[model samples]
Target: MFSEWKFTAKEIAEKPDLFLSGHRACAGCAPATVLRLIMKAVRGPTIVTNATGCMEVVSSIYPYTSWAVPWIHTAFENAAANASGIESALKILKKKGKIKHEHVDVIALAGDGGTYDIGIQALSGAVERGHDFLYVLYDNEAYMNTGIQRSGGTPFGASTTTSPAGTVIPGKLQNKKPIADIMVAHEIPYVATASPFYWRDLITKARKGIEVDGPAFLHVFAPCPRGWRSDPAKSIELSRLAVETCIFPLWEAINGEYQLSTPSKVLALAPQKKKPVREYLKLQGRFRHLFTPKFEKLTEEIQRITDERWQRLLRKCGMT
Candidate 1:
């Protein structure tokens, strides 16, 4: 028939519009774009469970919903638990001949707060039990849905409402939680770190994640214009810089086997040629405090964090 194979117009037309437009996401919100890309990648019957955060609050307002699929929203820290229950129920019903379906995919969505701080227990349990679902953490670095408070995902030297940068104290004193590494320690079927700047890479990884037979975790770097105080249009630029600087390396662990992606490969090939972390931090207001002369230590701290993380990743992947 066709010379090879491609996503024909008919096939594109047949893909479900799982996420609808007109939601209240801030301009240049990467997580919203992540949601779109993830939905496009998953091409089967799917149900979504959302933890209470920016995405859920915006997408499922009263008397309206931006979701085009079966979706449920729960408390700030229970999306994984809800998805686990839903997947279990679907399996039981299908076994008893109550429901006829070849595939029913379960997806759990949560912001960094829900994933890193409050919901880690639920996520760990779901992954340990090997639930057939995907857990995506849209890490905007702070609790953007609330008052721009600091969360476990917040990077060092970034000023937030709770972790203020003042004369006495620098921004956040701690580095971001190593979420992807934690998932890998669990030995999940798939664990990945991604950024919205690389849409094609993100989509490919998302497809692979959803197709995994057991648990999969995707930690996405989703920039927030409002919380980060960056130019709304620079969201994509910031995302790219994060990866290029090795502040957010792209990598994956499939059943404990690790491999670095494009950007990480470049870093590994020529570590000295990597982009400066300052070039990435200068774009965001959250890191503004680090630019001043007296805050030089903070800048060094941030760079140290980035380089250490990158080296650690290389070592784990055996690329060192």
Candidate 2:
């Protein structure tokens, strides 16, 4: 029996070429990046349950599968439920001495729509039950697989097919929901927000999630170029912009205590000069209508909200 178990930072960084190249993720899908990074940290037998979304259709298109590890594509709202079943079965099998190892890591992967909106009930149930597994949410901020539709995780004032920015309502009106905070409220051992731009921080959180004995939820803000109306080449750059601009703050919750993953020094150096929200908004086809003076007013409103949120995070991190 193994006395202790944990993955080192270096070991986690040395991920093998498991997720083969030539997969069908969008030109710059963050989920693909997350899958590769997570595989590096996980050892022994592992199983993945993916929700019906972009990652499902792109990576596993029938006979042409790109996953080098074991994966299953479940319903759009049942990835967490399916993973729970798998974990229970593995536990029974191991107890009966039918399995070689004492532990089999199981993970459920889902897009923002599945995690924050549709699949939330199942996710809440699984975590509340104290299951031993991890749920990685690749939040592209919308229903990218179906089309550029608004999801609950999508930030306010972001245009989408469902939340169009017209003369009436200026895009998605509601602010982005704090799903990580909800998970932390469940009292899980680990809950974190990671970004593809921050690979080191991403790997660190994933490694910790796996070692956590109970349910762990990781909300990863992955940039979707096609959906977000941005250049595919600027995917990573946008990821960095999201954090530096305080649009997406990186942090973690360990047993209900929160810690800002980005250092104070890094926070201090954040761009005092932020690009106009229009610069970020106008690139996407969804927000094409938001170019007029009225739209400019909406842009200012968004900026104000972003500033307030950033200041709040600064206070939360004890930097204020």
Candidate 3:
């Protein structure tokens, strides 16, 4: 039904913005950009359930909304559950001839705090039940809506309010939870990682996720300027650097088969093509401490971890 939805860069540029302007997002909020891309990819009637996070708080502040489609604001831990219910209701309505549309895309949007921690169980249950919907995780790596508190998605050695870098310890001690892998383990029909820097790829993945027959998951890397203490204008640059550094590999799993996305495919095949993680980390204040003499070794550890993870992904994609 959505075959005609495929779009060229110029076409996408000319398309109407489903995520309208004049809302309260940060100056260079990548998550806000991700939302716009996702909405632009929709080719039919869609219902969006957004978790209580930055996007929700900013877009839907009482008496105002940025969404052009039907949108529901759900609790922090139940965006998936809400989308599941919406899908089920759509099915029932269609069966009863109450709704004219045969297919209405259902999308659940959440942040790292909601997806990796609070909403994981709900998301797991929804996908396990094989609901026909899409779950998009806009991971800024911390609870940026409330404060820069560390979440399960926070990378190792990254400082946050809850995991501050101090004399005794470096930033967050634990590595980022592999939420995409966890979704793949659920055996969903489609699972992918995206970044706002690659708008076409992100839009393609969003379309695929929505068009899939069963549940789909998208883990999008959204740079948080306020939380990461990075320059607002460099958000897109940081996103690109993340992919080049293999800090966030672009890849997708379709029906249990993994394949590296175009941007990261060359990096996987040619290890030397991958930039050093430091190139990506140095721009963000959250990782500034890692540059200090006392915490320099922690930076090396982070590099080791990133390389290992990239290698693991290459193997999974059968590129290594």
Could you arrange the candidates by lDDT from highest to lowest?
Answer: 3, 1, 2
Clashing pairs in model 1, backbone N/Cα/C closer than 3 A: none
Off by over 4 Å in 1: 1-16
Model 1, range 1-320, lDDT digits (tens) per residue?
01222354466446766888889999998889889878877758899999999999889998999999999997988889998999999999998999888789999999999999999999999999989998999999999999799999999888999999999788898888999999999988899988888876787777778888989999999999999999999999999999889999999998898899987788789877789999998899998988888897777777887888888889889987
Per-residue error (Å), model 1, residue 82: 0.7
> Which residues of candidate 3, in runs, are more than 4 Å off?
1-5
User: Using lDDT as the measure, which candidate wins?
Assistant: 3
Q: In candidate 2, which residue ranges exceed 4 Å CA deviation?
A: 1-14, 263-265, 268-285
Clashes of each: 0, 1, 0
Candidate 2 collision pairs: 229-284
TM-score (all chains, Cα) for each model: 0.95, 0.90, 0.98
CA-lDDT, candidates in order: 0.88, 0.81, 0.93
Write one digit per residue (lDDT tens) for candidate 3, span 1-320.
Answer: 23546678889888888899998999999999999999988878999999999999999987989999999996899999999899999999999999999799999999999999999999999999999999999999999999999999999999999999998888999999999999999998899999999888999999999998989999999999999999999999999999999999999999989999999998767778889989999999999999999999987898899988988888898876
Clash count, predicted structure 3 = 0
Please give the TM-score that candidate 1 achieves against the real structure.
0.95
